[model samples]
Target: MKVEDFDMFCTLLRQRSGLVLTSDKAYLLESRLMPVARKWTLKSLDELAVAVRSKRDEALLRDITEAMTTNESSFFRDQKPFDQFKQVVLPHLLANRAAKKQIRVWSAACSSGQEAYSLAMLLQEEGARLAGWRIEILGTDLSSEMVNKARAGLYTQFEVQRGLPITHLVKYFKQMGDKWQLNDDIRGKVQYREYNLLSDLTPLGQFDVIFCRNVLIYFDQPTKSKVLEAMAKLLPPDGILYLGGAETVLGITEKFKPMEGQRGLYTLAAK
Candidate 1:
């Protein structure tokens, strides 16, 4: 691909999905987009790029963005965050908000539903303690395809093996031919939607906890700051924010402060 063409595609991705790609990522683009080209019956990625640059077909641009957004995810990925939520954060929220008996959590950029379902399983284990509480688990992703898959709540054997505990698996998932389907009750606990973190979050409402792990690293610094700021506005003063281990709010935003013992947990700073 030509340098100018690569730059144009990168810019288009940023405009559409808030993903920041550079010229060094040419190989990545080719590997991902080649399949898209084949799927659309185009001769080559160059042809797909030409279609994107024509600016005449809005649907083509949408297809390119969807092709580029990474959809990698697993159940209980990087276990520490969920453990902290169960041991520390959930207890604190239960105590502090006892009067309301409500807990709201948003799994921002949740891909394929594992993270949200993992949360549901953890809450389900709490049993009688959560009987009267209203738990809202909202999972959103920029890709509409991902949201649809999450809503379906079915996973292949290999997908189930990644970070999903055996005990919980047996208890919560039923065998559906060669695949596993999450129990309808646990699946129903979460509400999945298509959301773009780079755009308005107002329509999704607010939350007591937001899990936006491993997603901001794909964005530029300005986009990262914008996302964090938006998250801060959507959280309560004492709401918890969970980030990927490599991500942080230290240099980006001061609206959240890291919790002492929790590796990636941050509490929204009081105004």
Candidate 2:
């Protein structure tokens, strides 16, 4: 790709997905977009950029964005977040939301639904404690392909093996030839949608707890601040946000502050 074409591609990525594609990551972009180019019958990334510029085809633009943004996700990824959700967040929600008897969790940038389903499995373990409560898990991602896959609730052996415990695997999944089918009971707990985080989040309503882990690291500071503030608006005073181990709210936004004893756990900053 020419320097100009690469810059245009990077701009396209940022405008469509809020991802900051630096020059150093140019190779990464080319590598990922190659399959996209072939899929659209374009001979080169430069041609792909030309097609995007001239035609501005909605499908083509979406393909380019999704290709760059779609990333790997696994069940119980980075153990501590889930553990904290169960041990810390859940207990607080149980107490605070007792009167409402309903709770909603948003798995932002939820890739292929593993994270949402993981929460479902966790809640399932709660059993009698949440028997009468209405529990909702909304898994949103920029990739429609991933959202549909999440809706399918099927996982290959390698996918299931990543950070998934054998015990939970047996309890929630049934063998279907080479793949495992997540039980309908767990599948039904979560909802999947194709959404852009940079867009207005009001339509999604509010969430009690949000798991937006590992996503903001790709964004530049301004984009990160925008996303974090938008999320803060959706959270209640007691709402919790869980970022990836490598991500943080400090120096990014005043909407949240880290819980002193916790690593990734954050609650709304005091007004």
Query: Which candidate number has the best lDDT?
Result: 2
Give the candidate number with the greatest TM-score: 2
Give the Cα error of residue 153 in candidate 1, in Å: 0.6
Rate residue 84 of model 2 by lDDT. 90
> Residue by residue across 1-271, what tens digits does model 1's lDDT show?
8787788889989988899997788999888888888877899877887877675477777778888999989999999888898899889999988999999999999989999999999999987888899999999998888999999999999999999999988999999999999999999899999889988887888899999999999999889999999988888888899999999888888788998878889988767
Model 2 segments beyond 4 Å from truth? none
- Backbone-clash count (model 2): 0
Error of 2 at 200 (Å): 0.2
lDDT of 2 by residue, 127-150 (tens): 888989999999999999999999
**Sequence-dependent TM-score of model 2:** 0.98
Error of 2 at 202 (Å): 0.8
What TM-score does structure 1 among the candidates reach? 0.97
Report, for every candidate in turn, its global Cα lDDT versus the true structure. Answer: 0.90, 0.93
